[model samples]
Each structure stands twice: as C-alpha cells, then as structure tokens.
Target chain A: MRFRVFVSLKPTVLDPQGQTICRALNGMGHNSITDVRQGKYFDISLAEGVAREQAMREIEQIAQDVLANPVIEEYQVELLEE
Target chain B: MRFRVFVSLKPTVLDPQGQTICRALNGMGHNSITDVRQGKYFDISLAEGVAREQAMREIEQIAQDVLANPVIEEYQVELLEE
Candidate 1:
C-alpha cells in the first residue's frame, strides 16, 4: 500500500511564505498570479494488504499527534494499492 | 473561478528538503514515518466565468515558464467556482 498526504494551512490562517512568494512574483512582473497558499506533501509506502480504512486511521492519528498542528491546518489522504 | 495549483518534484528527482524532514522525524523518535516528499500548493482566486480548461492551460504555462522546472517537477491544477 502507498499513501499520499497533503497538509495545508487552514484558509483562515496567514501564510507568510505564500505572501513572500506572491511579492516575489509580482516583482518579477508576473501579475496574473495572485494570492498563493503553501503546503507540504508526503509519500509513504506501507506493507501490502493493509486496509485503506486502517491506514487512514493510522495516518490521521500520526498527523494529529506528530505531523501537524490541528488548530491551524487541514490534511487530505490518498491510498494507493500496490 | 479559482485555481489551485500543486507542484511537486518528479518521483525520480531527489528531494533534499523532504530528506531533511525525514531525518528530523527520525531524530525526534517518529520512526513510523518514512519516505517523505515535499511540494507546494497555490490557492488562486480568479474572476468568475473562466472555463476550467482555460484556467488549467494558463496555470500550466505559468508553471512551466516560471513557477517550476518542467524537467524536474509536475503540477496539477484545479478550478473552483465560487
């Protein structure tokens, strides 16, 4: 099994990195692009035959416990069978 | 319409930042986490009535031309209608 996790700042949260990149883009004359938010991706390979529901639960646990600050972030999980 | 662009390093490409994070995770005793990859997400708010296909095309152009190295990174675009 393989899992892909996407964690991002909640919409209400301020993203400084995204703002900086937006400013940089504007400075470089890329006006068409605007208001960017930044996030992180994680790809994990697990042993075969692990159920998607189980994996999701474990990943979500890992997320809330160690991977992210639940107060200001949200996450999505995708399970791929190998 | 709004566009969300996700740009990530190609699977074959080595991700130093992700590797560093993995090391940090291991050092912090999070041994269950493994094989991490890092990427960026952009949330763009576009004027209404733009077609999804058009938004995708422009985003891909921006990605290949300025936002990412096409040879090393891949991108996904999502159109959200408000």
Candidate 2:
C-alpha cells in the first residue's frame, strides 16, 4: 500500500521560504498571486502484509514524531489506493 | 482562488533528505516502510477576479519556471475549492 503525508509549517509559524517564493512570483509579474506557503510532501510505500489499521496507526505516529516538527509544523496522512 | 502545487524530485534524481528520513524511520522501528520520497507542496492564494482558466495558466507557468527546478524536479498544479 501507498501512503501520502503532508507536512507543513503551522499557520502561526513564519515561513521565510514561502515569502521568498511569493516575492519571486511577484517580481515575475504574477501579481495576482497574493500568498504562498510551502510545505513537505512524503510518498511512502509500505511493505506488504501489514494490516490497514496498524499501518495507519504507524503512519500517524511517524508523521507526528519523525515527519513533522511539532513545535513549528503540522502533518496530515492519507492512505492512497493503488 | 487557491492553487496547490506539488514539486518533487525526478525519479532519476537522488534525494538525500528523503533517504535520511527513511533511514531514521527504520532506525526508529518503522520497518514496514519500504520506500520514502519527499517533495514540496505550495498552497497559493490568488487575488480575486482572476478567471479560473487564466489562473491555471499562470499557475502552470509559475510551477514550471519558479516553483520547481525543471532540470531535477517536476511539478503538478491543481485548483482548490474553498
């Protein structure tokens, strides 16, 4: 099975990279772009035979403990159908 | 209007960050995780009054020219419904 994880800076956290991208876009004349926030996306392929529920639990734990910085980031996980 | 852009390393490109994360996860006992690929996600909010088609075209251009390095990365853009 495959899983997708999205890890992003918390709304309250300042994202300098995102700001830089926004500025670059504006400089390129893409003025209609008002805001740009950047984050991380992970595509994980799990080995076969793991139960769905267990896999989900493990993924959630991984997202919280390894994939995201709890102090400044947030994460979401979703199972993808092959 | 809002757009979501996903930028990922090309399959042929090596991703050290992702590899490090995978190793870390395995060391942490998530052995079921077979493969991990990392990418970037952008949540962009565009100013109002822009036609959807125009916004999409602008976004595609931005994704290709600014959001991603075409030499090593590929990007996908999608409109988000609020």
Candidate 3:
C-alpha cells in the first residue's frame, strides 16, 4: 500500500517563503499572479499485505506524530493504489 | 483562478532528508514502512479573466523559470476552480 501526506502551515502563520515566491513572480512580469503559498508532501510506501483500514490508522498516526508539527502545521493523508 | 504546482526531486537524486524520515519511522516501530519521498507544492492564484490556455502558458513559464530547478527537479501544474 502507499499513502501521500500533505503538510502545510496554519493559515494564521506567516509564510515568508511563500511571500518571497510571490514577489519573485511579480518581478518576473507575471503581473496576473496574485498569491503563493508553499507546503510539503510525503509519499510513503508500505509493505504488501497491510490492510487498508489498518494502513489508514497507522498512516494517520505517522502523519500526526512524525510528519506534522501541530502547533504550526496541519496535515492531510490520502491512500494510494496497491 | 487558482492552480497548484507540485515540485519533486528526480527519482535518481539521493534524498537524505527522506532517508532520515524513514529511519525515524522505523525507530518508531513502523516496520511496514518501506520508503518515503519528500516534495513541495505551491498554491498560486491568478487574477480573474485570464483565459485557461493563456494562464497555463504563463504558469508553465513561471514554473520552469522561477519555481523549479529543472536540472534536478520537475513540476506538474493543476488548475483549480476559482
């Protein structure tokens, strides 16, 4: 089984990196470009035979405990094909 | 209009950061986990009235020239409903 976990900063948090990108885009004459926000994702692979339900449980735990910093970041998980 | 751009390292490149995460997962007893690859994504907004094809063209150029390190990274763009 495989899963994808996306981690992003809380909306209330300041994202200087994203701001930098926006400014750069504007500087490049992409005047129509209005905003940019950046985030990270992880593609995780699990051994075969891991049941979907159990994999969801474990992957959720992994996303929470290992992939995200709850105080500033949030995460979402999606199951992928076998 | 809004779009999402996902940027990831080429499979051939070594991802030490991903390796560190794998080690941490294994240490945490997630023995079923086989691998993890990390990547980034950007949420970008463009002013309304920009045609889809034109937006795609400009976004592609922005992605190639500003967002991605084409030599080591690749990018995919997804248009989102306004």
Best by DockQ: 3
lDDT of 3 at B2: 92
Looking at model 2, the pairs that clash are none
- Per-model DockQ against the true two-chain complex: 0.46, 0.91, 0.95
lDDT of 1 by residue, B43-62 (tens): 76544565667767766676
Residue A62, candidate 2: alpha-carbon lDDT:
91
TM-score for each model? 0.75, 0.95, 0.96
lDDT, candidate 2, A3-68, per-residue tens: 999999999999999999899889989999899999998998899999999999999999988889
lDDT of 3 by residue, B16-67 (tens): 8998999899998999999999999999999989999999999899889888
Top candidate when judged by TM-score against the true structure: 3
On lDDT, the leading prediction is: 3
Report the Cα lDDT for residue B25, model 1: 66
Evaluation by DockQ, superior candidate among 1 and 3: 3
Worst 10 residues of 1 chain A by lDDT: A43-52
Model 3 misses residue A52 by how many Å? 0.6
User: Candidate 1: which pairs clash?
Assistant: none
lDDT of 1 by residue, A10-72 (tens): 989999988887787677765656677778767765555666677677777666666677999
Arrange candidates, best DockQ first.
Answer: 3, 2, 1
